[model samples]
Target: MKVDRVLLIAGGRSGEHEVSLSSAAGVLEALPYDADVAVIAKDGSWLLGPDALDAIDAGEAASGGHPFPPPVAWGDYDVAFPLLHGRWGEDGTIQGFFEMLGLPYVGAGVTASAVCMDKDLSKRVLQQAGLPVVPWEVVRKGEPAFVGLEPPFFVKPANAGSSVGIARVERYAELQKALEEAFRYDEKVVVEQAVSEARELEVALLGNVRAEASVVGEIRYDAEFYDYETKYTAGAAELVIPAALDPGTQETVQEMAVRAYRLLGVRGMARVDFFMSGEGELYLNELNTIPGFTPFSMYPRLWQASGLTYPELLSRLVELALE
Candidate 1:
C-alpha cells in the first residue's frame, strides 16, 4: 500500500490522557508522512491542527475543537493512527469509529481492542486458551471485594492501563481501600495474586495474521512496582532489551507472546507483558494493544533491539493497518 497523509489521534478521556499526548509527541517527531494531529481533550473535546499539536507539545489540556467527531474532513487522510491510550481510545471506541467511517487505522480492531482493554476478561480468555496467567478474581460494582487469593494482591481497574488506579495490598484490611481506588476508574476490578520478586518481561508483536515478536525486554525498576508514576517519570526505570534470559527462555517468551496475540485476534502492533517469578514460573501478565510510543516505551525499543528502527517501526505499523 502506498501511504500518504495520515491522521494521528491522541489524548483521551482516560487517566492516561497525558501519557497519550507524550506518546503522540514522539510519533509526530518520527512519523515519516504528512500527518494531521488531533487531540481529544479530557472533557471529550476534539482539537485539530496546530491547537492539537500545541497542546500535545505543551503537555497541557486542549482548549478548542468540537466534541466527538472533529470538524475536519476525514477523507483527506489515507489512514488513521490513534495514539490515544486507556479507555475511550485504546478500548476499541475510536477503532469502531474508524471502522464505521471505512477507514483503516493502526492497532487491533474493535473486538480485540475491547477484550484486551479489560484485564479480567482478557485473563479469562487467556486462561481458557490454556495460557499461563497469574491467578485473579473479578469483582464487579456493588459487589463484595471478596477474593480467595492470599494477601499481597494487586487490585486494579479491569479496563485501565498504565497501572493507573492500581494498588498493591499486603493485608486484608487494605483490600477495601484498594477496591475503592480501582472502582473510581472502572466498574469491574481484578484482584490478582502478586508474583513475588517477579522480573517484568515484555515482547513486542507486529503484523496482522502472521505477527512477529521482537527481542524480549526486561523492566528494571527501583519503585515498589511499575506504577503510572514510575512508567512516565524519566530515569525511574530501565528497559533492558534482549532481557538477560537463557536462549530457551527468550524463545519461550517470544513464542508465547505471538501465540497470545493470535489467540486474542490482535493485529498491527501490541506489547505482551509477562511475569517471571523468583521460582522461575512464567505467567502471562497482560497484552497492550497500541502500546506506548514514547521515547522511554519498551515496545519501540524492543523492536529496535530486534533490528527495526523507530521510524521503520511506525511505517510498518501503518502498512499493516492498510494490509
Candidate 2:
C-alpha cells in the first residue's frame, strides 16, 4: 500500500487515559512513516498536531484543543490509527465515527469492537462458538445478588480495560462494595469465577480475515491479581515469551487464539488472554482489541519474539488498514 500521511489518534476520557498516552509515545518513537498526531483530552475535546504531541510530552490530562470538529476539518490523511484504549476509544464509537468519515483505520470494526469491549457479551459469543470460557455472571447496579459464581471472584466493569475498574472479592459479603466500584466505570459488571492456581497466558494476533497468532506468552506476577498498578509499574510483572508449554498445548493455544480472533471479527491486531489450570484445563479469559503498546506491553513484545521488529509491526498494521 502506498501511503503519504497518517493520522494517529490517541488519549481519551476513559480510565486508561494515561495508559493511552504511554502507548502513543511508544508508537510515535517507532513509527516508520510520517504521521499527524491527534490527542483526545479527558474532557472529550480534540488536540491536533504539535499541540497533541506537546500534551503527551507534558503528561497533560485536560484537553487544550477545541471541541471535536467535522471529519473533513480533522484534515486529510491516507488512514487513521486510533490508538485510544477503553470506553469511547476502543468501543465502537470512534470506529463508527471513522466509518462516517469514510476513513480506513486500524483494528476491529464497529460490531466487533462493541462486542469485545463488553466482557459479558463477548463471553456469551465465545461460549456460543463452543469455546471454553471462565464461568461468569452479569450484574447490574442495585441487583440483589449475582448467582452462578463462587467466592474469590473477579468483579470488573464490563466495558473498561487495563484493569481500570476491577476488584477481587474473596467473600460474598464484599460483592456489593466491589460492584459499587465497578459500577462507577460502567452500568453493567461481570463477576467471574477465579481459576485456582492458573497460569496467565496470552497470544498476539495479526491479519484481517485469516488472522495469525504469535508464540504464546505468559505473565508471571506477584500481585494478588494483575491489577492496574501491576500492569503499568516498571518491572512489576515478568512476561515470558514462548511460554514453556508442551508442543500439544502450545498448538492448541495457537489454534484457539486464531479461532477466537476470527470469531470476534478482530482485524489488524489483538491480544487473546487465557487461563490454564494445573490440571491442564484451558479457559478463554478475554480478548483485548487495542492491547497496550508501552515498552513493557506484551503485544508488540510477542511479535518481536516471533521475529517482527517494532517498526516493521507498525508499518504492517498501516498496510493492513489500507488493505
Candidate with maximal lDDT: 1
**Native-to-model Cα distance after best TM-score fit, residue 70 in candidate 1, in Å:** 1.3
TM-score of each: 0.98, 0.97
TM-score of 2: 0.97
lDDT (10s digit) by residue, model 1, range 71-105: 87888888999998899989999999999999999
**Deviating ranges (above 4 Å) for candidate 1:** none
Compared to the true structure, candidate 1 yields what TM-score? 0.98
Local distance difference test scores for all models: 0.91, 0.89
Model 2 accuracy (lDDT, Cα):
0.89
